[model samples]
Target: MEDLKVNDGIVSETLPGSPPAGLESYGFDQKDTKRLLRKMDWHIIPFMSLIYLLCFLDRTNIGNARLDHLEQDLNLHGLQYNDCLAILFPFYIAAEIPSNMMMKRTRPSIWLTFIMFFWSVSMVGQGFVTNYSGLMATRVFLGVFEGGLFPGVNFYISQWYRRDECGLRMAMFFSAATLAGAFGGILARGIAEMSGVGGRAAWSWIFILEGLLSVVVSLGAYWAIYDYPDTATFLSPKERHEVQTRLREDTGHLSTEFDFKYVRQALTDWKIYIHMLICMAGFCPIYSFALFLPTIIKGMGYTANDAQLMSVPPYVCACFFTILASYYADKYRRRGVFLMGFQIIAIVGFALLVSSGNTAVQYTGTVFAAIGIYPQIPLGMAWNSGNIGGSLKRATGIAMQVMGGNCGGIIASYVYISRDGPRFITGHSILIGFVR
Candidate 1:
């Protein structure tokens, strides 16, 4: 064996008279590769999914709280409620690129775990805010801490799996948010019933209980989550070597250094902007939907409690469709087609929502919207990550996409204003234009 130095913390060895890049040269056949993938899925996916689940739950449960009279209790008149929701994205956008850089330097486990802890604390703080300004402050800090998670996690996942394998893996991770949407509806229903418990409103309990759950999960993540394949302690040294070699071959190169040159390269890349536009267009509908779904349902003449329960099915349908769409996208290795197809579906759903008057039909439109919007998020992300090469470039690219995309949250917060109640034709029409 000849020792060959490579960047990115990978230790490379060349076997005598063997192909340098082939898995066979490293004593890793198809069977060994399958086992390695299964092992990684076991260790990584569930923990990351759980983290994302809580991250989404903490950020979006405000919608559920809205039904519980959060606005009335906090004295949020006019656009104050929308302002509080809109404020999260600016800080969320500002922190992402920097956060990705920090993740690269500090390592995923430590950096991610640290951010998770602070964001959880921010979530807990939201429960105690007595006024709109106080709630806005908590939202800002919550944005700051949670900003790193999506891009950081996407970059981390790309490092573990090959391009062809990433779609389903990304879907599985992104589905946690959809699952959170479904689970959040049900969880909020139960939590909302706790009104006047310990002299606090049920909405207060939502933040506190969810935040506490995140704290426990964050504590466990330090041990449960693995770092890069090269540095992962759970795998054998031989397995680590196989991981490095396979990924190097797959990506054409690996990025070890956090250099300014890659950042400059990322800035100059037009593909980055194209992907950012795709993300921006997609996220408008998503954030609008997630933050306002319960409100929309309530506007459909359902009671507060029934609105919460009714919100569950759309998210549940979205979860199933996201995974199913990702399966085909990965299997066929055709991301753009799937993305465009889903976006069209979203547009149609919005069209239905805007043009319809029947209560049942409008509700069905939400299911179509959910199915269309949610799947494209992960698919688009995986597509962007798959095309980018090098760690720093990929990191910057992913962060850029997320940063630009989240700007849609600001737009979404305003588009679905309170006055457009019972039938948010204005918001629906605006989102339809966005998707198109």
Candidate 2:
């Protein structure tokens, strides 16, 4: 037992080890420590939002770029483009566990930033891709870099926030992805309108500009983010203590070293399977429509450019609903009902899109699709993160969920094709059936 002068409210307890050399060197009490920890959220949440937003932007920007001629120019016809999408998934599923393993071993901020830099570099390289093989390689590398980010962030959040607060934080971060969906249209449209700049196509500029922005923001994130409570230097010594104390209230133990055995046990757990199934079902409607949104909107009788413009509204609508649903779910400390309700709404939205003949009616259904489908991400992630007991378990569970949902990417890629373009019966119908 060693005496630690924590906050102004001095308290002495037998610490596990003799206080670090000159442990008494700094002036901090438990109360001050608690305040600093409370302040940490301000530093954390917004940056997480930025990270996911860049990821989403890079991913779906292809949708918009395709509108400007990525597919045709690159000679990606028939299943070739679809195969490129499908390629990313297997690699993503393969890389996720290792990425999370590394995240567990190193500073999450350091690892995440490194991943972002490379993914952005790949995204930038996509602009220069001359043919199918080049594009395929870029997408594969992009998937490898971005694969672990979502799960890594989930693992990082579990390290700091209490279970109760996790839902709202997760929702807010995930909402940025939805926002990217909404805003990407506008961004792509604006960039598309540029048409030609410095001898490059507008679509090329979209990739170049957005990718560079990701690199710069990631550089900033490496500096701004605090990986965990104990290592967070921005907080007062007192706040660091408070942060650790509060997390213990939920986990019963507070340590970053995850037990590998628990990770193995989590892999065999039934709950992981249920989450995987639900996520796979949920993502069918979500990503299927999302990835092909420009095409879907164009089918409604708009020009390619106008269709790109129209894609923004539904995504914006989805973003709003995501936040609302997350806030209410957290408020009541409930998950299942909110999640089911959103799934049903998503199913209804898809039904409307598939069943309707009127252009206005079909366009309206896009709004429903956005609102109904997007919120499931936060709800599902919150459910997994809340229930998992330890760092390794949480990491494995999140990685499993992400990998499982990305399998939906394969299903979605095959579901929506240019041949089925204008009236994608097979695509939206599958989405409706699965989400229902």
Candidate 3:
């Protein structure tokens, strides 16, 4: 046993014969570290990815419903449908900081599971709403419940992995959203065929079934997800100590204490604001594309089923490109170049969509846009999380970034309005401006 000394808020042990610092000093040699990370990937990544997949599907399924007469059933005219989409973000943005604070206090499993359960219930309620007000109410509550998930998961993953190791893991987690877009299209196509089942519309069945899936997954998450390194039950005592020591060496500080000072620090940090702006720029086009891709395809002269099927390829392309970009970004320790490059790709995509009258050319633009935009999300999140030192500061900073970024969803909901129809030049031009 060695003496435990506290330096700059980090508590670490001084082990004799340990290399001065880093994972090697903590007895996590390459083989052991690789094996441990593999275990974590198996245990943690899949579950977290699944949660995000469902979260995105629930949030954006309204887009799919639109193809199946959701607007008609609810009597939504003109901007009313857009209003339903826009209303979600106000409550979503308001709840993030508080929900993240609650996650810190109550533990990730409990806080996340509770939110997942409620958000799913809200999704289910969206199925039954008969009027615009009912739809608005459900959307608001859905936002409130889901507000914490992205940042909470980002912060939670930051605790378990070092900064350099986070990029691909963040990609793996975030690619689920792209996967949801792909899967949502196929699922919606199938569900649209079930229009008369139980006397409910096909669109209604989409919400009900997807929401039910979320509930079951939330229950499983309670048992599957691990907490912080110090409290994780699956690791051996030796492994836990090594893990914590490696992290302490990596960051130089890890404050689990609930302190307002850290909150103030996060709020005051210039990097936090810069990261928030980056997130906003990255997310604006993403939310718009996710919500409108099927419609955009349909406007290109595809039938409803063909449009839904067409939406899948862009998302699939996005999932592939996101992983590749994150891998190299982590390998070279260069995020800024990748971020700028991908954003440029998206700008090109939007330009193509706006300038071209040919349907194939516009559809190709969607693929470019998806691939370009999806990679930046995980890259931005990992970049921001990597810079923040303390656990408390990281939590607050991530929440702030996500909260600000989600405001883009409100902007997106309105950009491609009903009247814009086939070309939507205004929406594409607006997105291009934001990306630039």
Candidate 4:
């Protein structure tokens, strides 16, 4: 490894600037470092939350659009919609490693902004698609752009935050999924209600408005987000030294190193497969809401508008529980038990949804499913983040986790077939069993 001096510490990779002083080397004083890391958390969390919120909103607006006539207009049948959903994963898997590799070499600011812009364009293009083929192509393009986001954010957070702080920070970031789950429903309903104002379908309006929103947010992220601790031009040299020393102290290991061999080892290891298995098992329930909740809400004898509006409440409930769960998980510093506990709650919720005939009861189950499963996601990510070290390896590990969980995205897309609507027993059963 190449050694570069910054402040009083030796970094594995050097930045191109004059060094600052007062950065303690590895084995620094613990209390001072802890205080610095807490300040760093304030800088990191909001930036990550914004990106992930857009990432989730873009991925999931499809569920809201389905409530109107997206399926009917395109003449989709049986597994055709599911098939469109499935196509994204192959491209997502293909792009995962390469995107992270490129992000590592290039600055995250440029690459991540480029990615957001592409997805925003794809989201806008989705507004114009007239057929299943066009929608399919757009979804694929969306996947190619967005596949890097979660992994990239994961890698970025790991770079600055310490092991313990990561749990809460990651929780706040991943809770964007829950927030999108909550608020996207409201936003979609408002947008969908704009139908015929300019001679367009509600679904088209949904796409156009959301796409434009993403485009605006991407512009701000380019200015607000930083690459790494030492390279942050916005922070003064003293602040950079404080960040470097603080993170190293928090992790109990040097953070400046980039290790490719560890990444290869992470890829080949059997334990990582177990981690993948856990991700697959849980991610389905989470994604089913993203891809199918609007349809499921419509099955409950409500108008399209009512269903869209109703979708908001369940996700809002999810946001509350996700935050609550994260706060407690961080307070206790426990992960596996928390994850398993939520899975069991989710299993019960799915069971209730499948077996209950009452619409209100089933809706209650929907709320539980979101609450039970969503919070565990960030907790799981923080758990995995703490276990990995070095920039390249951490990036690869996070990418693997995201790809594994998202593999369930394809399964989720297919699980709720139109034929199985009204009583989506097969899909719910599969989701319930998978969580176990």
Best by TM-score: 3
Model 3 global lDDT (CA atoms, 0 to 1): 0.87
Over 4 Å off, model 2: 1-38, 254-256
lDDT of 1 by residue, 1-436 (tens): 3221221111222212223333454468867877998999998999999999999999999999999989988989999999999999999999999999998888888999999999999999999999999999999999999999999999999889877678899999999999998999999999998999999998899989999999989998888879899888889999998988877876666665889899888888787788788898888899999999999999989999999999999999999999999988776666777888998889888888898888988999999999999998888887777767788989998999998789888898898988888799999999999988
What overall lDDT, based on C-alpha atoms, would model 2 receive against the true structure?
0.79
In order, candidate lDDTs are 0.87, 0.79, 0.87, 0.77
Candidate 1, run of 10 with poorest lDDT:
7-16
Badly placed stretches (over 4 Å) of model 4 are 1-38, 233-236, 250-259
- Model 1 TM-score on a 0 to 1 scale: 0.93
Give, for candidate 2, the lowest lDDT window spanning 10 residues: 6-15
Clash totals for all models, in order? 0, 9, 0, 1
Q: State the lDDT at 134 in candidate 2.
A: 91
In candidate 4, list every pair of residues with a backbone clash. 7-20
State the lDDT of candidate 2 residue by residue for 314-432, as single tens digits: 88888888989987876666777888899888877878888888898888888988899889988888777676667777788888988888888778877888888697877888888
Clashes by residue pair, model 1:
none
Please give the distance, in angstroms, between residue 341's alpha carbon in candidate 2 and its true position after superposition. 0.7
